[model samples]
Target chain A: MKDKIRIASGSGFWGDLQSIPLQQVTKGQIDYLMMDFLAEVTMSIMQKQKKRNPAAGYAKDLIQIMKDILPHIAEKNIKVITNGGGANPMGCVEEIVKCAHKQGIKGLKIGVVTGDDILDSIDNLLKHGAGLDNMESGQKVTDVKERLISANVYFGARPIVEALKKGAQIIITGRTTDTSLTYAPMIHEFKWSWDDWDKLAAGVIAGHILECGGQSSGGNFLGDWRSVPDLAHIGFPIAEAYPNGEFVVTKHENTGGMVSVDTVSEQLMYEIGDPTNYITPECVADFTTINLEQQGKDRVRVFGIKGKPATDLYKVSMAYNDGYTAIGSLTYSWPDALEKAKKADEILRTRLSDLGLKFDEIRTEFLGVNACHGPLASEQNEINEVVLRVGVRSANHHDIEAFGKEIAPLILTGPPSVTGFAGGRPKANEVIAYWPALMPKKLVHPKVEIITT
Target chain B: MSKIKLIDIAHGRSGDKGDAANVGIVAYDDKGYEIIKKHLTTERVKKHFEGICFGKVERFEMPNICALNFLLHNTLGGGGTVSLKHDAQGKTLAAALLKMEIEI
Candidate 1:
């Protein structure tokens, strides 16, 4: 077994930078390249696309990325793992195969992990006593059964490790946990036991640190953002992992971003609810027990991560057709920008109200004033400009469409010095709201299939 | 003790979890961590974000990283695609919290 391995992050989300994967394979001696391309709402979007076309549900950017990095990764013997498969891992694999064939790269074994899409099995599972209740709202899955756009289980690193052991050069999956993409490599290379809670937790923590691509390596850094060098060419983070359940988070040589203790610590706290109970299918990682030490410039050593046994439940990400929403904005300039914007908002709302138009919610914000911080925003007087943005959400599509028509009329009739209305009338679009639930582990089975090019 | 902005001694980031928003505040040192730990209670955080956050505030400690995570429920109007707010995912909520004045 290898004593150490280098795992590099290629992309963080679905629309992340495409060139970063190519840079990762060419600029460094990395053993594995893991890219995460799924988010909570991405599956529903991909499901909508799949309904339109059978072979188009996966992340299209992955094809372009594969076309760019296939040759370099093939030459360097670097394996790849990603959940860019979205709603259709098979379709993603087909696209990757075509890209490999176009590049004249032969003998590539691609692994596809599926069975996570449980939209068809939802009813059956519910009948079998799996209520699939919404974790937040306590509503049963039956309430949103007809409106579900997508429903997929979150798989862990087990299937990816199985694919790795099967000699697959690349692994594609649907709805796999973002951390599992980074953690599977350590398990495969080190031959770590499945029951090693502490080791698995250490791997999970490393995965969490590396899952955001460059976030741990100075990208989107909150601490000393100005001190980070060359963010324009920021280097994504890489994990220099050892067999002893320890790793050093660093980037490649001659890279621009810094991987300091501050940057890594900030990422560790990102989007996490309870640090002590970070649940995954593999293990329940305890983030409170983590130990981080800055070894050198662009190097932070992470160790002493503890984890508990796996839970019998798997989290389910479901998206449904929530409603229709349309947003439009008009910029109002000084001498009284905020006042003008507020006046425009009031006029538009009054017009809608007078017309007897009904909506579930009509929200307005003066962009330059308090849009982000809301009431916490400090008062600003004598502002140069403020964008009067108004949005309406409702079950009625006509109301949203009608709300869109009122913005441009305000430019001429409601407020003076109003402009920047270039995008024409805002059209009503479907809002795919998220529904997070849980299912029994015994019901969901992850399937891994190896295909060769 | 003098009045100082929370940003002077701590840095943080925020993201959404369904309708709730979580802000993780990390102190620059142990002294700063202790100072914020004593003063930055969940009640204070909820009060600090009165109009924005509409639900209960829960705080979790991570003394290893010298950080505290505050989970502000029902803060995003509905979160995800349903919310019609500019910062639907509460990405800037941490920066908003940092603007609060604290006695140090």
Candidate 2:
């Protein structure tokens, strides 16, 4: 009531249960419904969609949800912000407008923020000396350029904020930071000036805390997870941020899950590279100034979040063609199944050598033993059937394809009790590389166009 | 020479307490689990966690879980928008603890 606003994240990922968003809108008194759709793989899948159909890139489920929640959203004046724009925001808006028209909503405004995905600009950018260095390896972008799959700049809340300033009802963006959806509502509602670093950072911090949905509200908590209440009905946290940079973390009254000072603090400490300099395009949030305390049973008071002027540069996420990779598998029955799998792996390697094809890397893992553990897996007994997965990555697509063909031949030639091969021939898929770089913030000027039905 | 077991720092998580770094250490059992205390001494821990850390390390023990919290300094790799591009593997201020290799 006192210059406060509520922002809630309904879905953490695509295919999340729809009832959460419905409950947030209907029961949580949420001012905004923010949905996150893009994962690392999500962009690739969306790219495939855009390749097949011009108007199909955004999250497909949004259209269905819009139809169901049309009456409630329109009646409550609740705005929705999502990065559901897989590869295209314009196409997403067009569909939303169509859905609105069918629902007989007269004044629904749709806004699209594009230009974050610049796969076509890679060559030009490289020519201009944007090395797009790998953060881990310090390698040049060219190392993975030809094999790139998806590249997207992580836009912050500026575009979404601009959309709100334009009075756009629903904002769709491509590859905006996960926290920006919640932060946009706070900035739009409070009219947070761009220079209000402390307030902005507070909002960003709040957004970051709750961005992963129930993770901040005790759902995915590693702390005493078993007693974390009904995880199936876990409540997502809402950040009620104010102009003074103080916010309260809370959830719906009867919702399942916990939101205490500790939960919020734990989430705040997650994925943080630096605390004092939580850098963002909009503002430089100082995580040190953050003060969290338990205000009530299901509420945490977040305060003292300080911030500074944001740097001129914005982080760019450009995916490039890194290399060609092929995965071939075989099943070896027990009583030397592991040995059989190992033999198949050696056979494939020898075949690749005979073909004189070299790859950057090759790895073989016995799935029943330890895939996640890798080298750390303890020695276990041979299983009934061992699944041998052989993976190779290289610049040679033909060689990779050839490696795929070697697996099926193993049944006739190499190993015994070889079954469990179901898939078709292996193919060369584009390798979407990750290029993390900082560009001047001035480069990205957001355009919010409201398509009224 | 004593070998520290995996039960020592199994549940450790770090945070800041004013200017100092406080590492919360929980031993595996309810008692003073020798593996954790053997390696997590203030002097030895300080040696195992140098260069990677910019601040002092304060230690504490917890019940119910074997965990420790160590706070480091200016970890966000100079926090701000600039640090977002840097991948510190979520170590940030606790770089020293990580560099010293505390395994589960």
Candidate 3:
């Protein structure tokens, strides 16, 4: 069994920096490069793309990243794992195969882990007594069944580990938990058993820390932002995993970001609800039980993570077409900018109300002032500029489109010194609402397929 | 005791889970954690974010890491793709919440 393995993080989400994977492959020694490209709403977007063009559902950036790093990857024998496959893992794998062939690299075994995309099976499952009720609102699937864009079960690290066992050099998945990509390498390399909750939990925490790429390694750090060095060439995070459910969060040598106790701790707490029961498809990790200590420069040792047995149900991420939303912004300058912005908002709303256009939700924000903090923002006495931003959400796209038209008119009719109307007209965008649900584990099984080029 | 920002003693980061936004504040030291524990109540947090978060604010204690996580419900407008606000996901909510003053 391997005593230690280094897994480097590449991409955080779908649109993250593409060069990150290449840097990790060429600049450092890593057993696996895990790129997380899927987000909560990414599946729905990918589904829409697939409907428009069957060959274009998966993350296209993955192919480019593979092409850039395939040469080094083949030379170093570094395995690549990612959920960049999005809605179509098979399509993503085929693209990778073509990339390998173009690069003159032969006999590349790429594994595609699928069966997570259940958009087509939602009706069959509903017939089989799978209610798939919204976990948050307790609403039935029938409430938005007609509008569902995508529905996928969150798969765990098991299938990826199985792919590794089968000698697959590159693994692509659909709707797999972001953490699974990082932990699957550890589980396979160290020969960690399925029931090893503590080790698996440690791996899960590592994955969490690495999932966001540079976020845990100093990029976008809220603490002492100025103190974090060389963010221009920020080094992505790497986990030096050991067999005893312990790892050190570090970065590549000569790299930019700092990997201290604070950074790792903050990441451990990001987007987490109920620290005692951080649930994944494979295990329930207790975030509160994690222990961190700075071992050396840019190295924080993480250990003593506790976890419970795997849950019987897998969390389902479903997105449906809720409505249309349009946002319009106009900047007001100098001599009481806050007042001018407020006046503009009032006038715009009055016009919308006067036109007999009803909206499900109409919201406004003073960009330079309370755009972020809202009521928590301090009262502004005088401001140089404040962007008057208004957005409306409604079922009728025509109403939203009309609302978009009203913003440019406000510059001449209502608010004075209005500028920054660079974008001509605010376009109506389709709103993809998220639906969280749970499905029985036995009902869905992950399918892994390996292709060689 | 003088009024001081939460950032004076602690630092935090916030992100969204659907419509809910969670801000995890970690103290610079054990003393700072104690100060936050006594002063940073869920009621206080909810009140501090009066118009921003229209729902309940639940705080969870993490004594081991000397951190407190506040989950603000029904915030973020509508979250992710649905929300029209500039800070739809509440990514900057932590920095904003840190502006809250406490008697130290």
**Local accuracy of candidate 2 as per-residue lDDT tens digits, A1-453:** 248778888777777767777788888587888888875456766876898998887898877877777778899988888988778888887888888888889888777888787677767666665456765346666666777667677788888888887888788888898878888887777777888888888888888887778867886454455667887787888878777778898999888889965466556655454456777778888766766667879988888777899887766665544456777777899788888888888887898899888877776778777543333345577578878887676777777787777778888988788987788766665454445666555545555666776
Model 1 lDDT tens row, A243-301? 98999999999878899989999999889998899999999999999999999888899
TM-score: which is higher, 1 or 3? 1
Clashing residue pairs in candidate 3 are none
DockQ of 3: 0.82
Screening candidate 1 with a backbone cut-off below 3 angstroms (N, C-alpha, C), the clashing residue pairs are: none
Name the docking class for model 1. Answer: high
- Can you list each candidate's DockQ? 0.90, 0.07, 0.82
The candidate with the higher DockQ, 2 or 3, is 3
Best by DockQ: 1
> Which one wins by DockQ: 1 or 3?
1
What does candidate 3's lDDT look like per residue over B1-104, in tens digits? 79877898888889999889999999988999999999999999998888889889999999888899999999988788889888988899888878888987
By lDDT, the candidates rank as 1, 3, 2
- Candidate 2 local distance difference test against the native: 0.68
The DockQ-based order of candidates, best leading, equals: 1, 3, 2
Residue-by-residue lDDT tens digits, candidate 3, A258-321: 9998888889888999999999987999998988999999999998899999989999999999
Best by lDDT: 1
lDDT of 1 by residue, B1-104 (tens): 88988898999889999999999999999998998899899999999999999999999999999999999999999999999999999999888888889876
RMSD of each: 0.8, 7.5, 1.1
* Alpha-carbon runs more than 4 Å astray in model 2: A40-48, A115-152, A253-257, A260-266, A331-340, A382-386, A411-419, A424-427, B1-104
